[model samples]
Target: MRVVLTTWGSRGDVEPLAGLAVALRGLGAETVVCAPGDDDFVELLARAGVAHMPLGPTVRSVVAGPKPPGAAAAFKLAPELVAARFETLARAAEDGCDAILATGLMPAGARDVADKLGVRYVLACFHLLGLPSQFSAPGRRPGTPSPEGETDNRKLWQQDAERVNALYGPALNEHRAAIGLPPVDNVRDYVFTGSPWLAADPVLLPSEGMTDLDVVQTGAWILPDDRPLPDGLEAFLDAGAPPVYVGFGSMAAYAPKDIAGVAIEAARKHGRRVVLASGWAGLSAIDDGGDCFVVGEVNQQALFRRVAAVVHHGGAGTTTTSARAGVAQVVVPQIADQPSWAARTAELGIGVAHEGSTPTVDSLSAALATALDPQMRARAEAVATTIRPDGAAVAARMLLDGASAAA
Candidate 1:
């Protein structure tokens, strides 16, 4: 079966789907991945041995860098509102395939292709795009959804629904008519994300309104095997025992120097070494006046395991990676989903938040102490082991099974 996976956004967004594509390839399914134009993602797909097609420029411009005040906000709502129009959609669909799976905001075009081909479509819900409870890690009992999960945050979801309608509804009908296929009952029906026949768990997912019968918790979908650690990382791990692992993933957009002094001071206070990642956002230079080494883009899963504790601006992927490594986390959220994941880490008792709104040497040192505590570290290790066996191959098989049914 031919399977096409479409996604847009930063490395965190595109990389998961790429992992899925690699898994699908293992099943002998023909797989193609589509994402906005970016050399990093392009190279990543190639390295993973997955076929890729570039859609457009990487849209990080909206989130970071100097731009129009609300440009990011507008694009966040309806990405199609700012991206290549229906022609791109048409072109993507032109490649015959059994099914099309796409992430949020970029689904309109893929949905058009799915309708044109009369094939099944699935939406990958990496985060709570419209779901409120899915917005934050709930404080409820395990496996229970939060009360506010359903309560619309001032009709934000309805706006998302409306935005979906405004962006995709017209093109959907036109595409259906062009192919002589009946229009779907409602645009939402084709939109399946959670469970029994047509659903699955959300990431940092709330448990409310879901039953054991509704969704399968396959744990977090991650790279099947841990990548090799860099040359200097092992030495860092051995330095003064496991020091706290501090690095924001791809979304960090601050001047590294501004953050460097604080991190070094904190590391000294805790009497631990520091391993900083200079990811796409350039965070390593924050090492001014410190002995910290800015390790540029190393294997996080492997590195996290070798660390005594972690401090980060919680992206979902980073959060899960740290959790799976069983090391306590000290979250200094930057923006978007960072705060929500930070709240979850604190709630789970595996970590603590920075004392102040912004992380500083004092607060970061305190959080590190809490994270490195024996009890917290043990708890984190247990959670990590529980979720570590997440089956990328199984998920790939599931996608292929869906495609085979479609065929």
Candidate 2:
């Protein structure tokens, strides 16, 4: 069997697809990943021994660039993203693969590509937001209309579909016309299809908001990381009681500008050292203190094991990693889906969900105080024992079995 897995957005978005590709390979199938052409993603795919096909421009430029009017950039990029994926997925599967599995809001091209190739097309999501639900209001994609103060789920979804149509319909039809496919009327349903795969830990993040769809809840697809911590980082870990960890991952720019120094001070207040990740936010030491160490692209799977508590922007990958490591967490949510992760952590009794992204020393210190509690740490460890690590293998088997039956 052969497969093409495609995804866009931050590292969190692409990593799951990479994991699935690796799983497929382990099962004796050919797999390739079509992802953003960033150097980070390229290196990641290389490490996984998967072929890569670049889609669209570097994501760093978009996130790092100055904010456009609210959703302006997201709106502008939607059509372009579909068109690029339309061409790239086709080229990636030119040799004729069995399926195209994609993650992210923009997968019209992948769907159409699979349709044209007469292969399976699967839409997978990392979170529970986009799928329609009467149980909860849907999250608005960037540049989509927000039903401010809206309570009705049906009305909110109607507006959501309209935005998907308005933002992507014309460009999608244009690409479809060129590909000799009929123009779709409801682009939203055309992409979401009937059964979308939810690649989240079912225990941690339940398959919620699925009134119209039969959502398949696969566990979180985590890229296997076995790299040892760098020598300096290991030395720091050994030198002190496991320090509080602080990093916002991709949301650094949007997070409070002073979060780094504040988080350091907050950890210090609890008489703990700190291991800071210089992620996209480019965090650094607040002072020349020996208690703080700043690192770059280190091994999270390894580092999380020794950390006393985690402070983060509540990214799905970081949140899941912390959960898997059995470490207490304090999630300071910055944007969409983050607040939900924060709530999950708090609800699980494993950590404190700091109300918002902007954390002051007092706020973070208070949150850390709760997260570092012995009881909370025990809960974290208990939860960690149940986080399934077979999501990729599960997804791979499903894809191959479905394709074989169809054939």
TM-score of each: 0.80, 0.97
Pairing residues by index, what is the TM-score of model 1? 0.80
Best by lDDT: 2
- Which portions of model 1 show Cα errors greater than 4 Å? 67-95, 104-106, 132-156, 163-217, 254-257, 286-290, 355-357
lDDT tens digits by residue: candidate 1, 1-407: 77777776777777777777777777788878878777777777877888877765565554556432253454344544323423455455566778777763445556656766677676665554333333432221111223444655434434444545554566566656665766654454355444522112233445445322244333445755456876676765665577767776665454233455577678779787777776655665443634576787577877888888887777777888788788898888765556667887788787786654466676777777788789998888776655635445667777778778767
Pairs that collide, model 2: none
Question: Residue-wise lDDT of candidate 2 within 313-376, one digit each (tens)?
Answer: 8889999999999999999988778899999999999889997668889988999989999999
What local distance difference test score does each model get?
0.63, 0.87
